[model samples]
Target chain A: MKDKTSKNQVLLKRQDFLKGMVAAPLVIAGLPNSAGAKPSASDAGNNVSYLFDSTKCIGCRSCTSACNQINDAELFSHDRPLDLSERSRTAIRVFLDDTKDKGTFIKRQCMHCLHPACVSACPVKAMRIDEKTGIVYNDPSVCIGCRYCMVACPFDIIQFEWDKKFPKIIKCTMCKETNLKTRGITACVDVCPSGALIFGTRKKLLAEAKKRIKKNPKKYVPKVYGEKDGGGTNILYIAGKDFDELGFPKNLGDESPAVITESIQAIYSWFIAPVVAFFLLFIPVSKNFKKVAGEENEG
Target chain B: MKKSEGSLAQQPLFGKIALAFVLLGLIIFLIRFFIGLGPTTNMSAGFPWGIWIAIDVVVGTAIGTGGFLMAILIYVFNKGSYHPLIRSAVMTSAFGYSIAGLSVIIDLGRWWNFYTLLLPWRWNTHSVLFEVAICILAYTIVLWLEFTPVLHEKGEDSGIMKIGFIKSIVNKLNEKKDGANKLLIVVITLGILLPIMHQSSLGTMMAIAKTKLHPLWHTPFLPILFLISIGFMGYSVVAIEALYSSFYLKRKYEVTMLRNLAPLTAALAVIWIAIRFFSLLSEGKAGLMSSSGTLSTYFWLEIIAVIIGTILMIAVKFSSSPRFIFISALFLIFGASLYRINVYIIGYNPGSNYNYVPSVMETMGTFALISAEFLLYLLFLRVLPILPAEHK
Candidate 1:
């Protein structure tokens, strides 16, 4: 009868320990907003943005040439760059339908997303957002050139310097440090003859995109491409055809990649903290428990 | 009560072949460094990552997970009978992670700036890759510390007193062994925690590439799936290593212990497959299986590999045979490796035009890495007291 009571007591203690181990992590994981909560949309309004009107574009390569002249050396061989490369920060991609009749020229560059996936994916903080200008920038010196940003980018705008022995990621910086500082605007916007590329604050550009769509419902696609796609890109687009038909990524919903990753990571981090604590505590606790059990066996 | 497991392997033929591959791979690596990635690799702007990141770092680390999984069984769960397997498991993990670290440097475009990964101020905590990198680095250190007892044991047995300089170092290490043993519980606990963190983070790294990755592989449940599958792969690797060591080195087969392990792995495999299918169904991505393409083919191949592996493992007839157990392990490793490859390469669609095929040099580099791992494993088994003195 005494042995049975002691055995039950031991079982109860073990169960209590197990319960503590499980509950500790649950409590920690439920901690209020451990990973900083998502930024409100109003907080992103001050960012620098681009307004690209595909209806007005003539497929001319002036912006591409201007971007090359500003960002790259004179060693570029192409007369009209068809795609964004290490030397080409931006390009004009011509998308045609099955019949090849309804052609649309989309100017491609960095989206500078409000919740940029590149910024979230970089192991090192080489890819950062400027607090003052709200422009995403890449620091080549600090970058280990993992190219994870290139993989994470939904717009597929980031390019790599594959030709260089010491490579760096290449993308549009909105002329923040160079042209915007020295010449007051971006080189591509300045050289655009068709008035397709316009640079302004995100709020103003978004309003302009909405106004263009509202004024000409039949002429435009009745939507702003970057307003909610991938949780809102700073670069806004207005096209005549549906954005998906014009080769824009359609599957990326309104949630930011950062939100998706961070939410999961936050929960993991919370749970890991308590689990690690349990393991650390288990060392001493188990030592004492073993001693007691050993005594019991001896007795 | 302790017994010796086995002695050093006598055959040098395997080691010699591995060395030749290593040398050939070194030449190609030099060419890669001097001529640039463009001339040497098939990687382009569209596909920045290739087999190095897919096979070496991602799958390679999963292969290394044997140590932590065994640590959990023997230490955390107090399954002391499995203790003999822990040293070999830790040794293999050390080699695996160290090679993965080396592969990371080789894959980096600016290899010279690799130190930035260690800089605390440079860390991006928001990034999943950051967590993986830090956890892997910490785990490698933990693994080395855990393996130190073998070195101390070797020093004590192999007459380290005859060597003047070596004697002092060994003595110092021996003197600290008691304290290390006391702290070993903590180290073993860390070993368990770190792999769980990093292995899952590896899958989380892909979460950011939602649009680029195929619907078949890119689910929010990736972290959990990766964690469970790696647990399965870890045990499989342990079984394969034990069986190979027994066959090649003329050691006694550890069939009884492995028999217990096979069922656990088979159960985990079922859980992994079920979770995969359930996630696909829940996410409404089951329609992707109907698409007659390379992506679907690779997906089905992964599924079939796991199914076959589980079948081989669960079969009552195969439970006692080391040879069958080894074959089952191979299938598990293959399935896990193919899953990583499919997620990172085959299932990845940056666009319709973008395609990547590893160059001969790139393929040689991967082969070199595996060969190096085998060679090192052999060397450590011979020199260090990694294996038990004999099978109990």
Candidate 2:
């Protein structure tokens, strides 16, 4: 009786392969959910930051042109890229309300969030954050050109090199590889003669923005922008006008979309949830397919 | 073991017109390779992704869920009487997914580095698109494998396998067919598993967009909503395909089977409508459904169309005629496609001086991708034993 039962088990081994294949991914896939992509106070590494004061911006756009020259020294074109384009990395746009008052000129570039939506959105890690510098950057070589990063960025700074055959994402990289490396300052910061754009560690720049706002409450908005905006951007802004009047989104909450998106995505990354889901799906599908196959054999 | 005597191209006027559109699409598709996306498409920095992504990759794949949807119905739900419908449903998915995969390369700026997607170390699993890309790729391959029995059946008797070495492989494939089917039983489950991952991730892609997406459409439940929406969209296409095949190919309709499916899909659509409404109300954007300008117009239109389709789908269960099924399928397809287009395009305001409307060439590119799907479907129907054998 024992020999016959062992033979029966041996014969049933073929069915076991199917079950094993279905079960193996569950075993191989996941560990328990760990500490996820929650944001901490000092998450944006070392936090090199840029501070811009709109009150001092003369609307001359010299810094914009300087940004064009220093980032891609080979490109000769320096006409203001009406809206930032592949050729133009940083842009100074003049925003006017419905009243169309003598509009305020605000410069726009990558905000380089502490928890970047682009970093979270890039499928290939083409966009990433530098741990030492806390600067968000893009690696064109790894980008599969899915454009998910472009869709995710709340700042609307990221653009595509749509016209080129060998195109890359066209956005500000905070001059991490260029002027920031050799000269230790961005081209825009170096060119801002009026002291509108300044660079320092994030903690220093943020404190400086608050001091300026505190000293002359009538001259500046009381709030230091990016203190809690877009999951606390590395860029700080203190403007004469309200962010809403200045054509900035009024409610760029302290929380990043990255954190929100990541919390939801943690299940897949944790591995076990999808593995369990696969096993649950497998049971019914296998049982039903067998039932149908048996009937097909009969009919 | 039987086949249709005539292919789609054999139809008198309709066949010629389809072939012409497909040829036109092919020519335009090739033209894009030389000229680049900027000159050929109306996409800009303000609007990086346009119709190709919004329509073809996102919504097209939603339509492609027909196979997985049917897999759930026949296998998971144990509604095995719908078994005759399975091969054709899988064929629809096979064509839809394979074509969507092919056309996405045209949209990618760096098409040569497309191979980087396969490199494991490069993957950013935190990204919803990463999950979507991996799942779609796995599902597309699995979908084709699921159709292998159909291919084997056709190839065994067809002219091509008569070649010497090919014939030996075909015989080997034939001999292992039963074993393959058992394995495919596992695979079909995988096919079911993958779509749930990717289809929901498609919505998660937008969820990360935050304030860029209009408040009316944005919600934490987007993934669940998208997961449910595909059931109705997939079922609608399955219904449409059933009626179209019966009408055009001189085959009988799976009337009772399709009637059974309508209630399941309608139930899904009902859940879809309720969740969308409550998601709006909870998000406190429900009032914007009327007060907001053109955005509200599109939202109301999408909801009303789905509501009408849902009611008609419920009515489809009470009747035998295929007309209501076809009309309701059209409405549901329109409604679901409109919802996606609304989320991806109309409502995606990244708040800069940026705007987008698809260029003539961009629209043509979309038409070409769609025509390729049609051409493939017709060609497959001609070559493979996809439609059911006659009962008599």
True contacts kept of 2: 0.74
lDDT of 2 by residue, A1-299 (tens): 34543464455443333433443343223221211343354544247888999988988888888888888777746687666777888888787756877667788888888778899888888898876666788888888887888888888778887877678887787888898998998889988988999999888887789899889999997888777887788888998888877656645687787765665676664466678877898888888888998888798
Clashing pairs in 1: B4-B388, B4-B389, B4-B390, B5-B388, B5-B389, B5-B390
Q: How would the docking of model 2 be graded?
A: acceptable
TM-score of each: 0.90, 0.91
lDDT string for model 1 (B311-344, tens) is 9999834557677888888898999889988888
Error of 1 at A181 (Å): 0.8
Runs in model 2 deviating more than 4 A are A1-35, A43-45, A96-101, B1-10, B160-170
Task: Give me the candidate number with maximum TM-score.
Answer: 2
Pairs clashing within candidate 2:
none
lDDT per residue, candidate 1, A1-299, as tens digits? Answer: 34544565466445434434454344334322213223445556767777999999998888887777766756454568777778788888998977988789999888888778899889899998776556888998889889999889988889988877877888999888767888878888888898998988888988888998899999998889888888788888999888887767768988776765765565444345637665675675356435433443464
| Native contacts retained, all candidates in order | 0.59, 0.74
Instruction: List candidate 1 stretches off by more than 4 Å.
Output: A1-38, A74-78, A268-299, B1-13, B156-169, B316-319
All candidates' lDDT scores?
0.80, 0.80
* Chain A TM-score across all models, in listed order: 0.80, 0.84
